[model samples]
Every structure is written in structure tokens, then in C-alpha cells.
Target: MQHSKLLYEKGILHNKKMLTQSQYSNFKFVARLDQIKTFTAGIKALLFAEHGAFMINEDGFTCTVEQGKCIQASLFMMPACFSEFYVDGVVHFNVNMNVLNECLSIFAGIDCTMKMLYKGPEAPLILVLEPQDECEISTECSIKTTAQEEPMEYSLDDNSSSLNVIFIRGPDLSNIFQEFDKSTEELEITISPRRPHFKIDTLGVMQSESSIEVAKSSDMILMFNCRETTKARYKSSLVRMTQKALSVASKVAIKTDLSGLMEMHFMLQDDSQAEVYIQFFITPLAEMD
Candidate 1:
């Protein structure tokens, strides 16, 4: 009994020592004026899922959300977007995006400045926001973090077929997505270097089948790299998710691998005068028997 009591005391001391050491550890981050807003809007696009995981390193940060294991969305902000960034190594944690977003937006129209801090994996995300205004209000929030789960890795590079490409300006795609037949279960995407470079087919309400085709030489086709025909079908819901990223993107590239995984790369400009990318991946619907 005495030995057991001594062991317990030793464990308590060790924990206290560890806690003290962590308190002195430096993990600090600060974003420039417009970066906070841009980051906020970027992550908001992933609210389709309930939770999000953030991985932070010297390169900056990546926020990811997975849906029903069928789709994965990721937003990356490079180190250039931050005014100051310091971290020992990669830090990974999960959080409720809905709650964290709300907290981040608490201060509005006040020239808000933001800082994030984390001592270690076990610590909560510390946000210090201050608004430079006559009122001079500041807000602090501690968002609890959870263990990071291994994210699904899509082996898009392993596909054997040549890459099929479709380049469309964001505004054009946004307008096209708006016309998508939401009533349809899936959106069929067909691409070839032939006359009709791109084609989208869907069944509208009342079982009406409709298809929109874009000519290869059309002005909307910024770049086309498909030499072989590639036809794949994706869930309308998953395709629609890209609309959020498209809203802020200057342009987007819709590419498909041989295995039929679609990757949407969005080109978003940051206030730091550099471009940032947000990528979304959707698995193609299996062919119906």
C-alpha cells in the first residue's frame, strides 16, 4: 500500500512538471487584416460537415472536412498570409467548425485583428481578437480541440489514364451550377478533345432530361487537355458543394483521373498579394447495374 501511494505521488509530480513545461512553450500565430476574413470565408465552405480538422505547420495551415466518407474538402492558407507564425512542428486537432466560425465572427466592421495560440495538442485553440475602433473592444475565446483522425487519402496520382481537364472561370461555373438540375440524382460530366469539349447532362424535375455542351473553341474553355474521351458521373449534391468555393474563386479547374476521382482546384487571391488554393475531392458514383 505504501509503495502504491508513493507511485501515485510520483505520477502527480511528473504531470505537474509537464504542465509547467508546456505553459512556457511558445506556439503563436497572427494573421493580417484581410487574412482573417479570407480564412473565415474559406472554412465556411466546409460547413457541410459537422466537424473539421486543422493541421498547422510552418507552411501555414490546412482545414479539412469529410462527408460520409464520400467527399473531402480542404482549404490551405500559406505562411505568407500571416503576419507572424511560430510553431514547434505540425499540430493537428479537430474542432466543431460551426462553433469556431461563430466565435471568429463575433467582432465585425471594427478592423478586427486576430491571433491564435496553442501550447500543444492537448490545449484548446486560443483566439485573441481585437477591433481597432473608437469602442476598442477585444474578444478572447478558447475552443476545445479533439484527437485528429487519419484523413482519407485519395490516390488520384496512381490512376493510369491521362488527365482530362476543364477550365472555367468561377463566375461562369457559378452560373452553370445555378442552372444544374438539382432534382437530378447525378450529374454526368463528359469531356473529349473532339468538337464538343465539355458536356453536362442531368435529369431535371418532372423527369426531363437536359444536357449543356460547350464547344472546344468556345471562349469559356480557357484550356482543354483531353485527347481521349472521358465520361464520369458524380452526385449532384457533391458537385453542388463546389459552388461555395467557386463563389470566391477567380477560376477553377475541374480535372478527373483515370479512376474517376474529380478534383476541383479553386484559385483564391489573398490580401497578402499572393494566391491561395482550396481543393475539393468527390468520388464518382459507381455505375448502376
Candidate 2:
């Protein structure tokens, strides 16, 4: 069999010390290159904010970025994605997203193998990269860390009225976004149970300003559920951020509560063909008097 693009073998040197005395003990954290790439690609486009929280636990790892506390983007990689995951306590660090993404993708043309480890908060993130060739070259990078910030909480709970929820194909939303007026400051989204189930209205710039609506029975809307009429406006720039995620996602779920808090769930399949979700939360802009 051909060598895998990325390799991660347990007890692979430095991380061996992370193991416990018990034979059943496993490394608290160790992951492959694919997991690293997948998680990073999911949130890279939403890293408008300078800071990102790298959180680790038994469940797996999650990278979260927030924009002025108004928009929150998260990429979650499940425990199964890691080669070995065993965390007795939570580990969190505030790291520069741009720097981290650069380090992860540094090896572009070369078939690089990686080994990742996390000792604790006091220690920096350890990454080892080796080119899969006779070069016998490997590089290790230790990224410094900072205190983690508490993430914003969004309630999509049962109590919160899910005024509107739509499941649409990624390409469909991508196409619609192309027609959005970039010159507009805000974009209006209206969802109702009536004839025009979903609508997008753009203002500013005569030619770019246009209103598009899709009926509940439209093929593009795979699923539609709206209890009552709900209308909300969001910054055109903020809503446009989802364009990247929309391109990779197979299906997209758009949800808005009564408070105008919007949640967009992107369904993505990993290398293993397992389903994973990348969620984005955007708070609607205040109404103009």
C-alpha cells in the first residue's frame, strides 16, 4: 500500500511522556494533518477577528473566532479525528489565527507528515512536520499562547422561537450571494409562511439593488419551516462572510430566532466521509429609525 499523505503513530517520541503510568493510558492529545487542515479550512475565512481560542478536551478540539463579539465562528473536530485523545482537564489558549494557519499550510508542494501535541497551558503548542522523502528533514514549531477569552453564548434552545429555518444547497446560496449588492450597507432577510417563503432584499446602488424570493415549494429550498413572519437586517459584509463556507458545504441550514440572532450550519464531510458541522452565528444590525 502507498504511504498515507499524513501519518500519526502513537508514542512517536516527544509526546510519549504525555502518557500515564497505566498501560491503558493514552496521550491526552495527538492528531493527524488532515484533521488539522479540515478544522483550519472551516474557520480560516471567518478569522476577521485577530484572536482565536484554541480549546482542547476529551471530546476533541475546537477553534473559535469572534468578530467584535457580534459574530462567532467555530470549527469543531470530533474526538475520532485524533489519533489519540485523552484529556483529564481542559486546555485553552489564545493564539494568532493568521500565524497558525500559515504554519499549518507551510508545506504546500511537499508531502509532509505531522505530529501535534499539547502539554498544558504553560507549554506552547508543539507541531512537528517532516517531508515524506529521503531528505531526512523535519521542523518543529512551538507557538506561544495567551489567556483564553470566554466565548459569547447564543441560545438556540427550545424556548427560543426558531422563527425560520431553511435547508438549501450550497451552490444555490452561493449563486444568490453573487447577486447581492456589495455597495449596500445592509441586507434584508424576510421569512414567512405565506407565498413568498424566503426573500433577500439589497439596498443602495440602483443596478445592484434587487429583491429575490423563493417559494416554499421551490427545489432550491430542500426544507422550509416557518411558524410566523420574521424579518431581520444584517450588515452586508457580515452576511457575505458565509460565502467561503457555503462553497465547501454540501448543505446549509439557516436559522433565525425571535431576537434576530442568526445561526448558519454548514454540513461538511471529512476525509473519512464522516459528517461534521461548522456553525456561524451573526447578530442582526439594529433597526434604523
Candidate 3:
């Protein structure tokens, strides 16, 4: 929020006498009571104090006239900053020095406490008198910037191709039995990197590795986990389980032909008294010479 227009609307352009002429424009802020604060409504006003950039709440509500670095600001070229009150009204604001002391007390147990501390616990501004020819008004201060830690980001390669992965959480023996017990799913188990190309089920070929946590079932949040020994990274095709009992074991003769093999058998494992879980990838092939 450039300070000029705020002054324009508030009928207070006369306050410009205090700004130190600089290339940077001062901030213009407007706010009203919470109930009356809106896009077009609010007790709007302009303040051109040297101690601009205030913070509000304990990092809750911040105003443009006195907000912090992380406080949301509008795009630089967007004509105005988003720092204005989302709703307007006469919400009271603390003075800069008081805000500093409050911030220090609240952040005492937080990380980066010292980094936020002001030199001698003073606010980042100086209260002073610029010589007025005949009279001196005493309501302004001067401010500057300080170093702080970087904000967080969760950026990933936007260009990476996404694969459709599935998961079977632990051991759903019912799903294991579904193969023979008359349950069916639109299922594509595993594809052969080597041909004859087809999905060959070694279902019920449970290993202790099938247990996993998938935040979303849409197959997007899950990514390739690196294999312990082979170090191969691939997204899980499934993340489900049947039961926790490992004693219940079942071996099934599946009707699918493995690549270059006439037969494929699937072994199912189970927990105490629960259902079973099936697991197997296509039989990896050796490269042709």
C-alpha cells in the first residue's frame, strides 16, 4: 500500500511534511471496526509515521501502517498491497515499541528468538524531532529493515510425469481371497518391463514391505519409495492390508503366465486371526545377450 493515496482519501495529505524524501513511497493503510470492515466499507485513514510496518495480534491481525515482512503484501506492480484490512473498522493497534515488547515476550519460547530481538530490546525506529521552523509536532518516528529467516516452500519438479500408483495398506486377506472367492476389481497388477507384455499376478505373495501410509487415495500424493536393497524407487501400486496375524499363510496357483515362465504361484500371508495379504511384482527378467 503506497502511502500517498491513503493520505489522499483520509483528508490528511497535510501530514506529508514528516516523510523524508526518498525513492521508496510510504505505506497508505485503511481499516475499520471488524463488523464494518469490507472491500468498500471501513473507517479508512492514512498515517505517514516513520515507524511504518506494524504487526498485529500475536501474529494474527496486521495493518499496512505497521505490519511485518511475512505479513501478506500485494503484488509490487498490482497498484496496492494486500496488507489492507480484509474487513474495516476501528480495530485498535498497539504502538511500535509496545508491539516490540509484546512480540519479544510471546516469542521467548519460540525458535529464532534472538534473531527477532531488537538491539537493547528497542523497536527498529528512532523517535526524533526534525527541525520545524517555528513549531515541533511530536507524533512521528523513523524505521528501517532487519534480516530474518527465509519462508518455507514445497516446490517439486512441475515437469515430472506422474504415474498411476495403487496401494494395499497392510494385509487384506479378503482381497487375497477375492481372486478365487468371486470378488473382482478393475485391476492391473504389474507390467512387464520385458515381454511378453502382460500383468502377471503373484498375488498373495506377501512380503513385510506392503504396509504404508497414503494420505490420499487418488494416487497423486504417493510417490516412489526407494527399495532397501535394490534402491529402486517407484510409487506403490497399492497401500492396503487385510489383517495383522502373520501365522495364516495361503498359497494359490494363479491363472496368469509369467513372462517366459509357464506357471506363477502367489503366496498370501496373514496376521493372528485376520484375513490375508497378497504381494508380488512381475518376475524380473535378465537382459538378453
Candidate 4:
């Protein structure tokens, strides 16, 4: 597996034109997929926003969406997800998520091969779909693209800051979230090295409070590393944005820094064992007196 890095730097665009003329003769990026369901699943998870930045590199493809400037979600599809993937250097563009989703799902319940092509930053993304069972059926779609915007910076330095990390099975975490009160306005998370190692508290709109505590010895907890007791409050709506990804993930690793930034990595694996990942970064809500 290739190591993937975030290519969100503005300076990287300067290198786009340096590609050889031969590369320009062909599309800057081209990818083929035979398993459309797996690809659509990841895309649907990041559809929280209307438009998103689409990035492709030698490693794979990534789509990122941000909401309220405090919450950001990214979906990564590795090269293994595509039958054929090629990129000159790195390509970044913006596209409408709803349009792309609809195009990909046009032939529902049918096995189809999808081919995607992008000539350059200014060119529209072209998708060609052909039913495998019926050679006569084919569809082509052209979705307009726009310049990429600077990605939001929401990173946590795990080594320098006092951090707490927890690994949990996806289904277990999903079940826990399902129990949260839907009318809650705030979700408070507390982690400690002592008893009731992990806890969640919610304050409803009516000011009613609910709390849940999990023991460190619980079977659902795969690993727990707590440097110190830490507690933070986050917007309930923002935290609930992860439900789609959580429903499909097999495992999840959550990390929180002293600054109250929360990061979660949700891992999804298909029947073929190919892995897809969805990540979320959330900023804590300000406290009141």
C-alpha cells in the first residue's frame, strides 16, 4: 500500500504546468472502476455539503467537505479501489456532490464499468458508464468543475499536546451514538484515567441532562491511552454528522488534543477486503459562564 499525504498546499499548483507535453496529450487524471457500489458508498458519506474539493494523486483519491467552518469531513479511496488509476502529479478541483452522486447511481441494480477522465483543471470531469451485462447500453456525463479552494487547517499534534486516544469497534460506537437524545443541543465528552474511564453527557434543549459512562475494561474498547483527564463540549448537530460513515465502518479510532480538537478515523472494508476511510475533525464549542 502506498502512503498517502494531504496535497492541500497552494504552491503545488505551480508544478501542474511542468508536466511533459506527452502527458498533456492525455488526460491529467484517469480512473476506472468496476465496483460502483463501494465507490458510491464512500461518496454518499461525504455528501453533507453541496460542493467538495476532489483531489487525486499517485496514492489515491480524496474528497473533502466542510461545514460551519468548525467541522470537516474527508473520504479517501485508495488506488486499490479503482481498476485503473493514473495521475500526472496531483490534481485538485471542485465539483457538485449531488450531481456526481446522481450520475454514478443512474444505473442502479446493474453491474457497470465506470471510466472517469479529466483533461486539466479547467476541464469538466467526464464519466462514462457501460453496463457489463448489456453491451448496447452506455451513458456519458459531463459535470462542470471549479477552482479548488484552500482546505481548512484542523490538525492536532499528538506528540506535543496532551492527547487521549481510544479505539472502538464501529458497531459498538454506532450503537452508543444511537442512544443519544435527539433533542440534545450539546454533547460533552469526558475521558479519565480513573473509574468510568470514558463518559458522554448531553444537555437537551429543555435543559434536561443525560449521561453515559463506559468502563475501561469493556470489550468494546480495543485500546485506551489517557495522558490526563480531559473534557470538552461539542455541538450535537456537528457530532451527529458522522452517523453515515459510522453506519458503514468496521472500526474507529478517536483522538482528542488538549486544545479540545476532536479527530475520528472511521475504517470501512468491503467483501473483497479493500479499505475505505472517512475522517472527521471537529472544534469544541466555547464554554459559557
Candidate 5:
């Protein structure tokens, strides 16, 4: 087996809307190296130890790294990760609440998390990642700066459980919008102005935007979106059927922990019955700012 390292500086991604699997289709991992870390064929156990600690520049902050400049993104750790580049010399990495939901949503297909926004990097940051074994987090660091809370958290739940959320956009199949520098990162879910019973927020998620938040109830949540009205009808019917198949699964999560059991089902057929189901699993993961 062979290992490779890549160095990315002031990445456009680190400054985009937000970085999530759903939003960023081609999520890949790259590491940095001195010369080369070679491994024999089938030797397995390819260990990638980031040379140092990591930090995410306080929101609108910045930093620079010496050697082990980084970002270790894996499904097992925090859902979303970010780093900063300052003119001085420091690299800031961080994970938070929103990123965690985005992470769980992509992996479990249902955002079923509640808390524990990761703050730093650590070995086996997540158990699921197969490549890098141990991650090194920087300690001697400081917040270079912070952005004006652009994607600030709202919704009055002291628990902030709503974050295990689903932002569903257009059944109209319209509108599309990634990032670490999430100062401007936004989640948009659109629904047809024609669709009934839809919690369509035409106000968008911003001052000049219009988006909808898919609601999760004691049982079901908006699992999928379709372009054609007929397909949505058919899919909705199938989802109802699936929900029935997993009847005991619909016991309602009053105070229950979703864990790995949350599942959302989505499928579209004809104009008759269409719907989608998103599986929600209270992930062992968390989101951070």
C-alpha cells in the first residue's frame, strides 16, 4: 500500500458556504508528508499521524501551520471540520453543532444527533475512518480572529435538538447552493408553492433567500424530494408502506435516544402516492461551530 500527502492553503472550500457530504458531492481526503511514507503491498496498518495539534481560526479568524498543516475529515469524528490560515503562523481547526448534523445527515441519511460538538483533533477521532490511524492536534494555539456570526444558531430549544434537522428544498427541483469559513454558509430547503401541507418558508433562510426546514415529528420527517408531482405521490405512498413495515420503529421518540435506529425512507413513483423517508440515527457524532 502507498500513502500520499497534500497541502491545501486558504482553500476555497474552507471559505465557502459550508462543507457537508450532501452539499459537496466529491468529498476526498489528502494528507501532508515530509518526503514519503511507504508501505509494502498488503502490509496494511498504514498509520497517518498528523504531526501536530489543530485549531479552527475563531470564525473570521486566521492561522498558519509549520509542517503538519491539516484537517482530518472522516465520518467517524465530527460531521464537519475546518481550519484557518493566519498571516502570522498558526493553523486553527474546529468542529461544531451544525457541522455534526450535516455529517450525520450524510452518513445516516437522517440527522438524529443532539449534542457534543467536538472542539479538537484526537487519535481515532472517529472509529469509522479506515485510512489515517492516529490524528495529532495542536496545543500551543490561539484564535487569530472570528467572523461576524453569519450562520449563528437560533431556535429557542435550550437543548438545540432541532439541529438534528433536515432542511428540504424544492419539490420544484429548483435552486441549489458549501465550507469551513461558514460565516455565510446557509441551508436552503425549497418546496413547491403549489404543494399543500408543506412547511414552505418563502422567506428563505436569509434576508434575500427562501428555504424550508423539513420537520421531524414523533415518527416521520421529510425524507426525500422529487421533481414530478406524480413521482412524489408514488414515493409518498411507498414511504407510508415502509413506515408500516417498520411499525414498531414508529413508537415515537418522546425522550427516546434515536442512536443508530433512526432511518428515513424516500422513494417516488407516479402521481398517486409519492414520499420519502430519512432514517434518523442518534449518531455517536456531534456538530460544532
Candidate 6:
């Protein structure tokens, strides 16, 4: 809950001579975590892509990964998840997620504290980990970082006329995905104001289909708002990428706009019960003639 001002001030003063005032003020991040598992869990959820852009700000840390220019996923870690969190303005950089995950898991199954520091875009991401039970052993890792490129934009227009929103408990929604046939190639989602208010259908490779329906009066559905009947189709594989987050989430929100762009928001809690979030944006598959 407290910022490590002394450490950041010292790090800034040391780099002041090497960097210009403007450059030094642009990117500087320092975060410490007593619960290493919390950080690792978040990174592991978005490991579908090897490389991801890390955006740090006063709010917390967010890592975004995009695939095939059609699907994007982000993992958000709030300040409460860290023992010491500090950032100078907003910082953006790219990192190898696989390597970072491995480094954090090195001391797995043990109680360890982590300190992460990034001086600027050019500097490597430095990680310091020390086991709480072991006094003499410690590890320091410096992972290479790259300049961030322009990320793909995929956001739903809130003012659209065809917008639909659904809120459901995470476990209930996750059960639907878990029951899906693995051989399916496409997933179709339908939301209507009539009976069977929400439905999910899948088409398999063997010319077979599966469907699951949830009524508006169902206990699992917290809220359902639909202006009209709306349906969209997306790649089943792309939609399954949320399994990691869904396994740990407590609640989820499903939204869709007029363009058929789908957005899913998942809420998770760490060891200390601090809320964390994961978001996925998926573009609908093109219609066949």
C-alpha cells in the first residue's frame, strides 16, 4: 500500500547523470511483491503469446498480448497485489513473457519476495528474488526488453444501438466453456430477449453441433440486457484462451457491440483477496457467402 519512494529516488538520482531530465522522467517503474504466486499467476494466464507489451501506471501493472490481429488479451494487477508499487507517469515496453514466467517460477513451492525495477525503455527488466526461509540464497535476473510497437485497437462502442451486456458468475460461465467439445472449430453466441435468453452453439469437425442454453431467470445469470436478438461467431480456439483466467475468476461480464466485436471481463482475487482482472477482445469470424 506504500510506495518505495526512497528506493525510487535513489535510482532516479543515479540515472540522472546518464539520462536527460525529460528522458529520465518518461519511464521508471519499481514494484515489490511479497506473494510471488500472485504475480506469476497473472503472467501465466496471458502466456498464449511469447511477447507482450507491459504498461505500468499508478493504477497497477497490465500486460497485453495480441494474436492474428483479431484477438487481444490483457492481465491487470492492481496496486494492492504488490507490497511496494511505484511508477513515474506511464511506461510502456515489450517483454518476453515466457522468460519472465520461468524466472518467477524458479523458486516455486517456496515463499519468496520479488523486487522488479525498470529504469527506462533501453534498460533490461531487473528481477531480484530471495527466499524467505533461506537467508543465504538469492537470485537476480535481467531479461531483455524491446521498444513497444503500436498495438491493435479492438474496443466496443458503448453508444452503439446493437450493444448487449450479460453478467454471470465466473464458475457458471466457465462450466459452459468446459463442456464445449474440443473438436469444435467455431463458436456461436446468441442473446435474445425471449426464452433461452442466452445460448452458445458450437460446430465440430465431424459435422456435429452442440448447444447450451441459459434462461434469464436462471440463478447463475446476474443481469441480462439485450435490445434485440444478436448473434456472433468466433473461432473456438481463440475463445478458449481465457481458460486460465476463468479457472480463478469470481465473476465475468460479457459484452458485444453492433460490429459483433466481443469483450469478456473476468474478475479474480489474489491471496489477500485483492481484486485482479483479465480482459479478452475477440473479433467475429467473417460470414460465408
- Which prediction has the highest TM-score against the true structure? 4
Clashing pairs in 1: none
**RMSD in Å for all candidates:** 8.2, 4.5, 22.4, 7.7, 20.2, 5.0
RMSD of 2: 4.5
> Candidate 5 on 21-67: residue-level lDDT in tens?
44222222222111111101000111121121233222222111111
Model 4 stretches astray by more than 4 angstroms: 1-25, 109-111, 131-135
Error of 3 at 18 (Å): 14
Worst 10 contiguous positions by lDDT, candidate 4: 1-10
Q: Tens-digit lDDT track for model 6 on 114-190?
A: 87879887888878787878756767777899999757878877887788999999999989899988999999999
lDDT by residue (60-175, candidate 4, tens digit) is 89999998678999998888888778888999999999999999888985767787878897888877787778766777778999999968988888695479999989999999
- Compared with the true structure, model 2 gives a TM-score of 0.84
> If scored against the real structure, what TM-score would every candidate get?
0.85, 0.84, 0.19, 0.87, 0.18, 0.87
lDDT of 3: 0.24
Ranking by TM-score: 4, 6, 1, 2, 3, 5
- The Cα error of candidate 2 at residue 38, in Å, is 2.1
Q: Which ten residues in a row have the lowest lDDT in candidate 3?
A: 70-79
Predicted structure 3, TM vs. truth: 0.19
**lDDT tens readout by residue for model 2, 120-215:** 665667677666673356666667778898888775754545567889888888898887667977788888899678998887756356789999
* Model 2: per-residue Cα lDDT at residue 261: 81
* Per-residue C-alpha lDDT of model 1 across residues 1-289, encoded as one tens digit per residue: 2222332364421242222344324443323343376777787788898889888887888888999768999998777777766656678889899988888778753446676767566777866666645334556677898989878886555345567877878888888878876688778888877856789888555767778898878777688778578788888888888777889988888888657788888888777865577889999888832
CA lDDT, every model vs. true structure: 0.74, 0.72, 0.24, 0.82, 0.22, 0.82
- Candidate 1's C-alpha runs over 4 A off are 1-24, 28-34, 108-111, 132-135, 158-160
